[model samples]
Target: MGKVTGFLEHQRVKETYQPAEARLRHYQEFVSTLPVLDARTQAARCMDCGIPFCNNGCPVNNIIPDFNDLVYRDDWKSAIDVLHSTNNFPEFTGRICPAPCEAACTLNFNNEPVGIKSIERSIIDRAWEEGWVVPQPPAVNTGRRVAVIGSGPAGLAAAQQLARAGHDVTVFEKNDRVGGLLRYGIPDFKLEKTSIDRRVRQMEQEGVTFRTGVLVGDWPVGSRVGNLSTETVSPERLRTEFDAVLLAGGAEQPRDLPVPGRELDGVHFAMEFLPQQNRVNAGDRLERQIHAAGKHVIVIGGGDTGSDCMGTSHRHGAASVTQFELLPQPPEQEHKPLSWPYWPQKLRTSSSHEEGGAREFAIGTKEFIGENGRVTGIRTVRLAWEGGRMTEVEGSEQVLPADLVLLAMGFVSPVGSVLEAFGVARDPRGNAQASTEEEGGYVTNVPGVFAAGDMRRGQSLVVWAIREGRQAARAVDEFLMGQSALPR
Candidate 1:
């Protein structure tokens, strides 16, 4: 505790954002950092709970209380050290994570959780500015080689840890550049590419070899979601060359809405539309770029991916935008008494929602109405929940004009080709079958083969991916050697 009664004396404060009008004009980060003094005050608001649920709430199990105290005392270097001890990339989580930690805070029982997210962001930003973040090269070589597929958060975390453990680590990515989804799936407005590039540079210094445009699976050009093809690399070559192989490819099998007129020209998946904009933002020439200008856009699904499409459409000057959700709208506020210290079911209005968009809840799409094979409108019907089952209400049908339709419903599972090629057993849910127990954890049916992150588990947050990667690395280290010193 930096201050004994700081939590009682101070109130929680969050970081501010730039004006909507100004921020929408460019694909750059718009979040403004809090003043140093204000950040310290916010950090001081962390109470001394007998049990810190915030630590438990965090997927990476970050030492929240210790970092909060360090920030409160202006020991930013030490704060970043504590944060990096658990999380490999605090900047990424600080910006994009939903911060379940706040919900698990003791104060959240009254809906007044401490500003853990903002304090975390501040600690990392200060660390970078002060040049405290550096590479940690291994002191000795283990004379072993490991191959990691996919350069996303999970793959990067595993590769870095294995490299620091004196194992030769190599990352293979299909994209021309590293960062599988973070490079293309996300927009620059939320996270700039420089953050990834900087870390890549550091990882290089740490002796991690990254081979971009080296696809490990057999896929044709323009077939791997958004006209990006994988670089040809045989699985036989990897197995023969590396001591161990870890598959960290994310769950990329997007759930498609295969309804009437689904093959229309104007209708596309969120993955197709999102990656094009990301490529353009990265200064690549995109032939026949998809734009929402002067069009009435309807985004199907009401999750983070859908919100991202809404924001991108607004930036493209869409004449009108609407988001649809099949489920009923949750209450604006959750009953804290009933859902204390756990993620509650509540209405979440994202920053993109604040910009502009019509949100429809309890509505189900009946069909996609089109003209001459181009999407023109969407026919929908109101829905009601009865006995835990949803049913369409008769005589509540309507049609909304839509020049463009984007399917933003989440992903189903990882692409089966890679897993099948490797002959790894899959769970009932279509993910790689692997336990997290101490024995046989993260080990695939194939010897010397391990799985982690979205590839092993289903779709999840970036923080969870990092945690899985770290744990998987430890498992691999233990399997290679009798005992390991890596953190789990």
Candidate 2:
């Protein structure tokens, strides 16, 4: 602990952001960093708890208390080293992760967590500026080859770990660029593509080969999600060419709102709309692009993706924005005494929500109203939950004007064709079937093939994906060499 009474001496300080009006004008990161002095002061607030719940709260089990002490002691280099010890991408998580670690903070009993996320973001940003982060190429090659499918967080984390362990690692991405969802699905404002590009460069220098626009399994010809690859590499080729294969392809199957008029032209999946803006920002030319300009937009779903859609639409000059949630709105604050050491149920108002929008909870869409094949409005009904079941309320029918509708419902599973091509069995929920147990962790039914991340664990946070990737890398290394030095 930095100071025995630091928690009482200091209060949590949050990262600041540009004014909503100014940030809405461009798709660039607007969150400002805390000054070095303030960061240290905040870090000093970490308590000397006998059992640090923050460590357990983090998916990758980041050594939170140690790093906090390091930062508070002005040991900048060591602070970053401690931060990087567990998390492969603190910058990514710092900006986008919900910071479950803070929720699990020992101080959260009173609802004021240690501002761990802000400190994490500060450490990484300063580390980059100070030139501390660099490639760590292995001293000797193990002569083992590994192929990682999907370039998302999980795949990237696995490939980086495997390469550092002296294995030849190659990552295959269907998109034209690296950084899976980091590259395209997330808006540039939250996480810039340059961050990913810089990391890719470092990975390349560390001997990780990336092959973009190369599909590793059977994707139906001409079928496209956010983006598609023209070239296809069969699963057999990968299984034969590489000693081991790890599938980290994320769940891409979006759940559809199957109400009436679902086939209208203006209705689109959130992925479809999110990636186009990213592509356009990257200087790629799309003959046609989805726009919210001068349109009243309705985003269905109340999760992070829906918030993203809300932000993007505002950037596109949408006339109005509204978000709908099927479940009732949670309380404004969590019952801290009962939920001190876990993620609590409560209302979450994102920065995007503060920008501008209306949010309706306990509501369900009844139908899409369209005019000449284009969505014009949405009909909805109020819902009441009784004994864990939702039932429609009488005399609650309503219709709202909607020039554009984006379905932000979460994904269900990985694409069936991709899994089928590898002949990897899937769990009942449609994720690649695999266990996280020590004896046979991440191993698919097929020999020499493993699965991790959303492909195996279903849709989850980026932090969880990194954890899965790191663990899976150890599993693969052990399977190939009978023992491994890689961290789980």
Best by TM-score: 2
Compared with the true structure, what per-residue lDDT tens digits does model 1 show for residues 1-488? 54667878988787999999998898899997777898899888888787999999999999999998998899888899999999999999988899999999987887488888888888888888989999999999999999998898999999999999999999998788888788888888888989999999999999999998776765554455346565667677888999889999899999998888888888988988998898998889987998999999999999999999999999999999999999999999999989878999999998899999899999999899998889999999999998889999999999999999999999889989889878889999899988898484899998888999999999899889999999998888888876789998
Residue 354 lDDT, candidate 2, scale 0-100: 95
What candidate 1 gets wrong by more than 4 Å, as runs, is 218-230, 438-440
Give every collision pair in model 1. none
Top lDDT hit: 2
Could you tell me every candidate's TM-score relative to the true structure?
A: 0.98, 0.98
Look at candidate 1 and tell me the lDDT of residue 343.
91
lDDT of all predictions: 0.89, 0.92
Displacement of residue 273 (Cα, Å) in model 1 is 0.8
Q: List RMSD in Å for every model shown.
A: 1.4, 1.2
